[model samples]
Target: MNFRELHQDGCFLLPNAWDVGSARVLEAAGFPALATTSAGIAFSLGRADHDYGGGRVDRDTMIQRIGEIVAGVGVPVSADLEDGYADVAATISMAVEAGVAGGNIEDFTGDRARPLYDLSEATDRMVAAKEAAGGSPFFLVGRTDVLLVGGTLDEAVRRANAYLAAGADCAFVPGAADAATIGTLVRELDGPLNVVMGLTGGDLSLDDLRKLGVRRVTVGGSIARALYRHLVDAARELAEHGTFTYADDQIPQSDLNALFDPKTH
Candidate 1:
């Protein structure tokens, strides 16, 4: 099914992948669709996430990596293009050219003094992205970082609704995790709502979110963080104790070879 159809009725889990290998693994696990995680990609590249100024993972590298992930998986992939790297429409056009079925454009400015763009400007950006998409079957997700950056729920709702009106297939509010907040957002949002799970304080399960009427659930960078934590622990064990106990339950090399083989996998 297409990305937009996944959000039509029931809720679906959109796991984030940082590279071709990760994307293939997630696709093998049977998810109908996948998404790119900016944080995960940055950390894998030895940088920081959400580099709105192109200081960390520059726009070109990010686009190239996104293309790689899309090429690696058969399932539909969504690009998490953070703030469109300051050129919203152009970045989205690049993402479309990269073959992403859909992508997110957030309202975060990356400046502490003014963390989010003004509602008017943000709506304009959404319109530009929609127009850039043209007749392509691209799903445009409008994301608001207001609540994630300490803004009020009312303001978040306002910005999200405005973006939806301007031309967004879905509204993504990342910070609302609790049952009460999520329920309120579901009730208040005029369109499909996407909530990111697995962050700190996000204990709700898929069933919990589905019961709350959420249309989409994503686990932004949590999977990547967990994997890195395991790597760090294994390194410490090998360095401090001179042991290799972390190799337990590792995926067999032959199995991975088969999984990656073009003719068989």
Candidate 2:
């Protein structure tokens, strides 16, 4: 199914892949669609996610990476275009040109001093993004990081509804995981609700979120974080204890090769 159809009914897990290998792995594992994680990509590039000090990957590199993932997998790929690379219209155009099924445009500014854009400006960006997509078969996700920045639920709901009116296919509130808040947003908002999983305090299970009427659930960077946790543990073991037990449960190289091989697929 296409990316837009995935959000039409019921809640489905959209796993985020940081690279071509991970994207292919997730597709081989039978995920209907995949999303490009900004944090995951940053971590892979040896930088922090949302680095406003020019530490994160460059815009062209990110666009190329998203395009690579889209080419590597048959599943629909949605990019997590951070703040639409600070240019709403241009970023949306770039994403569509890259052949992605859809992408997210967030309202959070990378600057810590003033983390979020004003509601009016944020809505305007969403409008511009929709205009940029035009008649393309693309899903535009309007994301508000209010709760992540310690804003009230009322404010998040208001921004979500505004973004929907501005032509977002889905309203993504990243830090809303509680049942009450999820239900409230579901009831109040006039569009499909997208919630992030595995964040601090937003750990609702799939059944719980589905019951609350959430239409889309994304894990953000949690999968990458979990893999890095294992990496740290293995490195620590090898450095301190001089052991190689970490390789005991690794996937066989032939299995991975077959999975990645075009003939096998």
Clash totals, every prediction: 0, 0
| Pairs with backbone N, CA or C atoms under 3 Å apart (clashes), candidate 2 | none
Assess every candidate by TM-score: 0.96, 0.96
lDDT of 2 by residue, 1-265 (tens): 7788899899998999999999999998899999989999999999888845668777888999999999999999999998987688998999999999999899899988999999999999999999999999989999999998899999999999999999999999988878988999999999999999887635578999899999988888998998999999999999999999999999999998898898854
Instruction: Report the C-alpha displacement of residue 50, candidate 1, in angstroms.
Output: 2.8
lDDT of each: 0.91, 0.91
List candidate 1 segments past 4 Å from native.
51-54
Worst 10 residues of 1 by lDDT: 47-56
| TM-score for candidate 2, residues paired by index | 0.96
Record all residue pairs in model 1 with backbone atoms less than 3 Å apart, i.e. clashing: none
